[model samples]
Target: MEVAAKPAIRGAASIVRALEAHGVRYVFSIPGVHTLSLYRALDDSAVIQTVLPRHEQGAGYMADGYARVSEGVGVAVTITGPGVTNILTPIAQAFADSSRVFLIATNLERPFLNRLEGNLHELTDQLAVVRPVVKWAYRAMTADELAPAIAEGFRQLWTGRPRPVYLEVPLDLLDEATALAVEPATPPPPSEPAPHLIEHAAQLLRNAKRVLVFAGGGAVSRRVAPLLKEFVEAIGAVVLTSLMGKGALPEDHPQVAGAFGYRWSPDNPVVTLMERSDLTIVIGSGLGVRTTANGTMPLPTPLIHIDIDEHEFGKRYQPDVALAADAAVTLSALLAAVHAGARPREGWTPEEIAPVKHALRTPPDERTARYVPYLEAVRAALPREAIIVNDMTMLCYEGVRFLPVYEPRSYLFPRGFGTLGSSLPTAIGAKLARPDVPVVSLNGDGGFQFTLEELGVLAHYRFPVIVVIFNDSTHTAVKVAMHRAYPGHYRDVDLVNPDYVKLAAAYGLTAVRVASPSELEVTLRHAVEANEPMVIDVPIALERYA
Candidate 1:
């Protein structure tokens, strides 16, 4: 019998094989000249699903959204130069939010890479473009280096501090023949705090009369959320989730102070709780400038900050005890120490927590009051399991402040990067990742214009996402700021918006406008039941959408 011959495989094919080995299910991509070979390999692969987005930015945001919702890392493929530049915003957004997005882009051929000969799609240094944003950036110089580089990228993306990774593959490398069996490498386990540190932190928790646990986006993972719940209950500590950490512990839980509670101001009830607490445990949070109300919020002592990155310990607020460890690992060890033999005393009782939380929830401010009915409609129409992505808009600011998120991964916002026009494509990628879960995209007319063409991608795929446009016909957030600064003076802030209904109709999607909350609830219910793509345009003055 004749010996069997091996199948032909190129460097590009090896990349696909590596992705398959890593168990990546989806890749958001845009086809371009230099990346045709990778696309061809992706087309041949049966396991990986390639999604084409209208713009490179959409592709990156989609990958970010997919990473946020799914258990695995998200992948995006693009060509060199413009493709890389187009994707920087989403990459930065993902980095800011600590989402795991693996960006694979092509570069000029090896010979002409730095020749300054105006090679097609040439960038002097493509890897440099993404270095500040991505956790790691690499340029694979040879066919043999591709698999190892990919393994390292995944290792960085999944372990320690999770963030985006950028890998640049030169065009010439794709021509080399290869048969490397690149099996997936095991990612290192999460880091645990030292025993002495865990015990010392436990002593603080046990001895303190009042304990406050402040969690951020780092605690939102499946491995970490349950530990958080157990830890909070074990110590009877009052829990407050940052906006990015929303839904990490169910908001309905009596222990959860409130979403974004104490994140904004000095006099807020949540901040008062922070002020009075004797011991505060900061988990998976860097306490960045925005989350800490631009550093106006005080750091309560004796503060113990637990984070995967040590550099974050003193960046925004100083900590008395800084534990550099993974949230889940540190939380697990801390819980064990707290539960060792002697039970810890309850920090805040239901009676105490109730009043503070009630204050946080009550007396909706002017901005929040404007969004209540519409938000209630959105909440009433969708199931508890549904996921909602919020854009950076006036409505969304209030939405994140008041939205009751009961499950991990159920709520998403552009928290760190604070980008506008993020929700639509993000929701599309989310719906694609979890088709069983209902998705809604909330945006203001002004921010929605940034990625308006992405609506066409949603229409083409018919992803059954309800897109709600709060049409004020101006950048309400900026306009409000301008009023504060200039008082009775405005310049070029107003906009002429397209008729959203007609625009949706042209995209072959169901379009409706509602003027009342009841109408919005009813129409959204119908749309959900029908499982169809829809656009609900609610004019801001009238506050209606369906």
Candidate 2:
């Protein structure tokens, strides 16, 4: 008997297979007509879970969060035209934060491409829109090119200086049948800094009387943490992690001076450490505007900067010596050199950090005391390994100051982009990436409503992410700005919100409304133990925290 012929796999099916082969655990998407073929193909993908968020922007943010926590490529698929445009903000945010996201977007048929024929979901130059935000963008003209494009996108994620990439697949091509084989493209190994560059850094460090190690987000990887700790210990250096680099070294560690907390007046112990030091070693940070206090903080002379991105070497504050290499590798080399012999940094004792730590422990004022209860409740409800996603709000800055994150990738925020409406979806993505750990999102009333529809997704997936919405019925951050600039004239900054308990019920999520801070911990504990998506609406006055 003749064997049955194998059914032909369509291009869309191959794309799914490619993503699976690259070890993507989930694909966040908002399906439309142009993406029907891709969705149909995805239906049979048992290994790859599909998360359908309410909007394209939510999908993109979810993917970004997944990548950040998982340390893997995050995948988001969207339809042509409006879908792509809707997701642009998140893509731009990912680019700014160095998050790796792979975006697969559908486009009109090749014949209709850029013709201005007004075909459904068509753009004059869709690729042009994505190019500015992504590290790379490619358009596949034929069915066979789909898998290759995806492989290249993954390659970009695995390579140096992680960032988002976009791949456009024409609608007609996804429907076509094609035989394709895709090989996983492993990123090239981390490059080594030139021996002379390393030697120069070591020599300068050797002669320095006061040394400070400034760790950035790039130094937050697990492999780098131990080496970084070793380097700091060997040199008797004080550690000050940037906002993005929180938890890179243990905050509780005696050597660490803690993060430069908020963007306010900036008189933290970290700033004190920077001011007193004669030499600063910047590792794996771009020293961006937010991280550097917009260049207002005085950086000491004879700086040594190490970064994976060559462009960042001299961009923010030029260094006396620069080394381009993986943070872990460079830290290891530096530690070795310090052991070989360096000018001993005398009087750099842990006692010096005591006053700074005391200052960090002190609340800014009585207003900040109001948030302590909620933060205390959250800390009690979750383990140290639990992840927190903070939206644009006063609590975010407070969280940065008070929340003790013990592990890398445990705290995420829209720091670089400073966008609202990100915490909810990003929490979902973080939970999806690490299902065993508890993930909680802290969002303000105004920001939470921006992505309210994602409640449906959280309900559907049942990922057990606890969202704490600070409901004061206003855009508190904007209101604060308005109040500062133009007193008693806060127009369009306040909002009238729907009852959150009823809203949560409508989305099939468990809900509890807490009127006082005293009631939060018990309610949070109960909600977290429920093992389902839940919302805790705290009726706190927004002005109290401001």
The per-residue C-alpha lDDT of model 2 at residue 450 equals 86
Candidate 2: where is the Cα deviation over 4 Å?
Answer: 1-8, 264-266, 542-546
TM-scores, all candidates, are 0.95, 0.95
- The digit string of per-residue lDDT tens for model 1 on 1-546 reads 996766657998889989899988889998988988888888899999888889999999999999998856889998989999999999999999889999999989888886679677777777787799999999999887888789888998878788999899999887778766696879887787888987778777767878888888888878888899998888888888888888788887988887754248766777778877888888888888778876677656888998888888888777878899988888888877877832345578877888888877764566457677888888889888898999998767776656778778888899888898999999988888789988999999988999988888878888898899999898887777778888777778789999999999999989999888788899889888988889999887632221
Please provide, for model 2 over 1-546, each residue's C-alpha lDDT reduced to its tens digit, 9 standing for 90 to 100: 997765667989989989888888799998889989898889988888888999999999999999989888889999999999999999998998899999999998989998888688878899998999999999999888888888888878878899999999988888798877767777778778888888898898778887888888898887888888888887888887777888798888888877767563555556677777888898888887767766766777789998999888776688998888888888878877888896546625799877787677667678777776677777777778888898988778777777767788888988888889999999888888888888999999899988989999888878798988988888887888888888887789778999999999998888999887668888877776787889999887746323
For candidate 2, list the clashing residue pairs, or say none: none
Local error of candidate 2 at residue 311 (angstroms): 1.3
lDDT of 1 at 187: 83
**Candidate RMSDs in order:** 2.8, 2.7
Error of 1 at 13 (Å): 0.7
Candidate 1 regions with alpha-carbon error over 4 angstroms: 1-8, 261-263, 341-346, 542-546
